[model samples]
Target: MVYYAYFQGKAPDVTKKRFKTVWDIPKEELLAPGHRMCQGCGAAIVFRHLLKAVGKDVVIVQATGCVEVTTTVFPETAWRVPYIHVAFENAASVASGIAAAIKALKRKGVLPPDKKVKVVATAGDGGTFDIGMQALSGMLERGDDVMYVVYDNEAYMNTGIQRSSATPWGAWTTTTPVGKRWRGEWRWKKDIVGIALAHRVPYIATANPAYPLDLIEKFRRAFETEGPSLVHVLSPCPPGWRIPPDKTIEVAKLATLTGMWVNLEIVEGQPRVTVKVPKRKPVKVYLKMQGRFRHLRDEDIAFIQKVVDAEVERINKWVGEEAIGPVVEE
Candidate 1:
């Protein structure tokens, strides 16, 4: 008697040896140069790495946000593949419609049935976790054959650095400013991944630009998955996060090392922590490095530490183990 699972032979191993540096990324560039992204834009890095992993046989639907605004400026467009720009709160919904059209076309022999084109929707925290939640939820609940990737910078970076639902606790934003009434963003970061998990999508994961290999691998898995896939990437914004341009990768690394952000994936309803942090660093090390957390008092920092510790504890409980976070060298 032979027993098996859907995980067996589901897809080929496309993760070519673990990637380490920027040079390890593919030479082919999908997003053309000469765009108006920031000096040390993490979103651009995420876009490039994801395109490298997903390849060119895809269609992209970009919601109105930083990436869309910066890349598509009227007469100038940076996208090299088939791309569409949608309203601020409807990228996923538009992508769903496109996917449905493709399926209908293929069935009617109007489009090549042998060729497969993946639908990918890109948005920021403001568009995804806030304004676009309804449409995004609809897409996920409907089980559309599309990938919704949210490049979470934790705030509305393009709109004067306002606070979005993805903003973490104790961080300062324009809206969640330090004042007599507000001590930075008092509310905790919204768990966008958890919301996606509730929909029980076929694939769900978290990625960070700091770990290029891991980020790229998650994209590959998302594209290969048949049903809806949600990938939440913690893209650090230089200005919004109040960090130096060059410290983008370093800051992002500290986030994972301090257990503030844990790399995870959900497959067949089984949760797994892909990156292992073994010995977690103190949250202060991660918070003190960012300017956004500069206003945090001793008590505030302690509060953040408690939040991080609780998050790490929760992840450990789910994985049924300890020290199970991304292995990034401190």
Candidate 2:
């Protein structure tokens, strides 16, 4: 079933522009420097911008993954805000508890009645799409007032680049290696956004680091909305994807330009494409840059392009406009 139309209603007023210029953004740096993340780690950028958008009155519950290990090494921490490191499969569960605690404290006069603190749960694709699915489902079903952000790098990059359900079709990883009898990952990427939509969350978005303004605006919306919210970010890994550190932003922008990734948000049961692609670049332009798809044959690339085209067409039809256009050969 097409999940984009699942939430059919009047669209909210999203015409107002926020962050017109870089100077309009707050200068406060919530995420300090001097961490151990790689030079071009896209997840690090996601965290930095997220904190800036949400500000200092937030509690971050992060799963044990690349960001957790790299940022919070025993004696030092890069986060300037309240942060808790939880097990891989329970970040959502912990965040739910924290939200519940804040409510209880406020009711009993233990905390100020007007005190507002945002509870955010963060995890990688391995933790979100695979191990933490059950916990996240429970949090959504229970109607917890927490925002869950998944910085998907496509695989378990912290554990040697193993394949996860979020990994794209025909992408090579340690487990899904290209060989004589087998190609890369045979299955399509899991639809975490659709799954979250099924739970009837108040807010859901897909973000990329290449578009900082859009990403920050989505975070602002998620924080303002009540009930459970989910933001799935496409975080490119330099080491795992076998790309140079400097090409992280370039590859991320290519994903959206090629219709491989769509920036969108669902607010109050209304879905809209945030960034429109009038003329999509061929999917090959995106696939050729990453070493993970280096071994894919011509036919394999054609097959992948066919899948992307169908998906983009479906989205365009649902939105009643050509938000993403047909692929054009370059």
What is the C-alpha local distance difference test score of each model?
0.85, 0.89
Per-prediction TM-score, please? 0.92, 0.95
Prediction RMSDs, each to the true structure: 3.5, 3.0
Query: Global CA lDDT of candidate 2, please?
Result: 0.89
The TM-score that candidate 1 achieves is 0.92
Per-candidate clashes come to: 5, 0
- Model 1 residue 162 CA deviation in Å: 0.4
Give candidate 1's total backbone clashes.
Answer: 5
Off by over 4 Å in 2: 1-15
Task: Give one digit per residue, the lDDT tens place, for model 2 in 150-211.
Answer: 99999999999999999999999999999998799999999998998788887889999999
Q: lDDT, candidate 2, residue 271?
A: 72
RMSD of 1: 3.5
What value does the lDDT take at residue 70 in candidate 1? 94
